[model samples]
Target: MLPQRVRLQYEASVLHPDSLIGCGVRRIPEGSTERYTRWINTITQDQLTTQVYTSHGPTVVMPTWFCSRNWFQRVGPFDEGGKGVPEDLLFFYQSLRRGGGVARVDHCLLVYRYHEKAATHSVLEETIWNLRVDFLQERVLSQWESFTIWNAGKQGRKLYRCLSPANQRKVKAFCDVDENKIQKGFYTYEESKERPKPKIPVLHYKEASSPFIICVKLDMTGGVLEENLNSLQLREGADYFHFN
Candidate 1:
């Protein structure tokens, strides 16, 4: 029972009648039955870790998630808020909010479903966005007094506008490799309540100072980004973070 609970919780696959099966687990689809479900006595962490990444473990497994029954009582039960609440996602975020690590074991124990209208689809896109933004602001932005926004493009400016006012004032510069935005020299804060629009200087990526919050999306721009960042001699973590 311990082996079953620990092994298949993350990876869910049907087991065949010809193979070994656990008590109370039945009605597995024919041909869907996994060939390897023969009675299991013990399972190793490596096998488990592989399964974890294979299916639901990617969704809920934490590398260091082990608590006694008493601990569970202290941690409380599932948030049974039902559909549209994204109870699982909310719980994961709260775990992180309480200083939990994002982790996963390498195992395949659970038989996960590939459903069309799962609970995940019920959560609104806007809800996810707001949650991500709030988490990002809480986990990262609060630490820095100021940071330059990379790109100076539409997305970058949009992020600047979306930032809380205090964070907005911390935007020291707008930077880009594009000659057009760079040639313009500055981006005016047309929406600010100040008497005059705040003119934030735009600099070529090479010229712009570091400690940047990059709005640049990866795997796009034909590797021009790598070249630009390399030219600046700026190390990634020390000099910037991706907000894209």
Candidate 2:
């Protein structure tokens, strides 16, 4: 049976004359692995927006997505990168980029079967990371004059190094709670050929500035990072964006 939530979301999405795309997802995964299920269920709004900038978070499979033919045609023709390509994510990102809106059914009306050898498993982690960074640069960083990167850890440092030189120059600092990182004081760009190279300061999260590009993964810090973020009273999207 089609849940009322799904029906209502569809109705509202299509009722609009302008272009719209919606994902009516069953958050619960049937017969999925515990690790996959846990990660899927724990996805947060910030992480979702950071990942795809969609309100419905990241849909693991296309079966969870529902949209009209017209809207689909407008944003359809999913990336033909084939096999290892994250076609669903790319399409969803494009739809949103073209002024689309997302709403979730939040009910288990569909079943998601997970197994080894799935097409999703074929995609490389680096491919996903590159796509997300590109999207973030195009959508968010382009508008900001300067920003900080949260977490001075490996992931955070990698993000800084990978950013375009123009964007890299805009990184004001790296912030983290790790005493070891904070004690190091600054991150030196050893690869740069500049006479002095470049030194970016590392400070405690409380002392760091925003709007920040958070590289810390969600649900992994036992709420320590979340608590610090909350204490700062910084609004997601505006004051910060997650890259992790």
Candidate 3:
């Protein structure tokens, strides 16, 4: 699935032919008799592809990884944090950063077993959040001059409050389809140390600007949000990005 000039690993267990599927590892428990984990579900190419950027995890388990020796050397070593660290994830991000490619084979090639003593459990949720945010800043926000946040709800506000000061200033406004949020007019940052704080304006989605940093999760709404987004005719990853 790799391009002629691009170095990539092809996975068949979960990818289309001639296309890279960042494969997902099937999670299992040690000494368990179940054929599949409770979470076992069909994974498609679209989900596998987006997981790298959106979820910031190894789309494929490390064991299924296959690449040329030279490419492996270029990608370099995994984090030696030993435990409580997502070394595979770290390496995958690095590979993407280095222009490495990823694809998945549409066949189950590995069984990833988990146990109470497994190191994966040691990684905290907050740690992953911080990493995802950092990666977002590095990969997307840095390239844009400014952007709007697509939601005026708690999640959008939280993202605004958590961003680095420099990135925080880049937020033009928050947009929403919710009438209540739009009627409120503004969001005041009570947590800011500035004497007057910051009161960010909230506007209807139609009036908002793009490129947008969408804080709204996909597939949760009953097509309303998607319809609104589609109406704008903006391109994803260029005119807008998703942080949800």
Candidate 4:
């Protein structure tokens, strides 16, 4: 497996020198991080970039990362900020900003171990959340003049609050299927210091416009969210980007 990984990495490097090439990873405890493992392994080639904003951090897991020395040097000096700093994710984002690409070998070549005392567990979720939000703003949100958020719920509202004032103003509305939230009509920015405050409307998904920043988690809604999203026939990366 190690030799195969090296061979594939070398071939990929020759083919895509400016890309971060990763291979599929199998978790040590078999089922540990099952969904995440499945996601890492199965995401389409385009999703390597499209899905980067998710809580999953890098679409390609860090452990399987293999890139040319020149590309690595160009994109990094991974934050030597010690523990709790997500150096891999920071580097991955930096590479993307530099116009680098992401590719995968599609063969499971590494054993990704999961342990309670792992360094990853030391990093606070808030730290990652803030970073993801920042990257989303830089890469996706800045391109849009205005957009709707897919959920009128907690995660969506949290994303709205995290946006800069300019970006906050760009949020046209919050869209959801929940009758209670839609009946309430709008989400008032109670924490905003603005005079009169901001009250963004909450509407049914079918009534909302795109492009959207979908804050809804995939799979958890038992296909309801997927069904709602597909019903609109909108394109990903352009019409919407998943932030959950």
TM-score of each: 0.61, 0.85, 0.74, 0.97
Cα lDDT, model 4, residue 140: 89
Candidate 1 lDDT, 124-218, residue by residue in tens: 76666566556556766778877788989887897788778887888889999789999999999898998787889999877778788777864
lDDT of 2 by residue, 134-243 (tens): 87889998999999999888988888888899999999999998999999999998887776998999999989889988888766788887888999998887898766
Candidates 1 and 3 compared: the better one by lDDT is 3
The local distance difference test score of model 1 is 0.56
Over the stretch 36-151, how does candidate 4's per-residue lDDT look in tens digits? 88888998988888999999889888888889889988987999999999998899999999999999998888888889999989899999999999999999888999999999
Root-mean-square deviation of each candidate, in angstroms?
Answer: 10.7, 3.3, 6.1, 1.0
Cα deviation of 94, candidate 1, in Å: 1.7
lDDT of 3 by residue, 112-168 (tens): 666677677789867776887888788888888888888999889978887888888
The alpha-carbon lDDT assigned to residue 186 of candidate 1 equals: 97
What's the residue-level lDDT of 51 in candidate 3?
41
Off by over 4 Å in 4: 1-3
* Clashes per candidate, residues 3 or more apart or on different chains: 20, 0, 17, 0
Query: Top lDDT: which candidate number?
Result: 4
Candidate 2 backbone collisions, by pair: none
Ten-residue region with minimum lDDT total, candidate 2 = 19-28
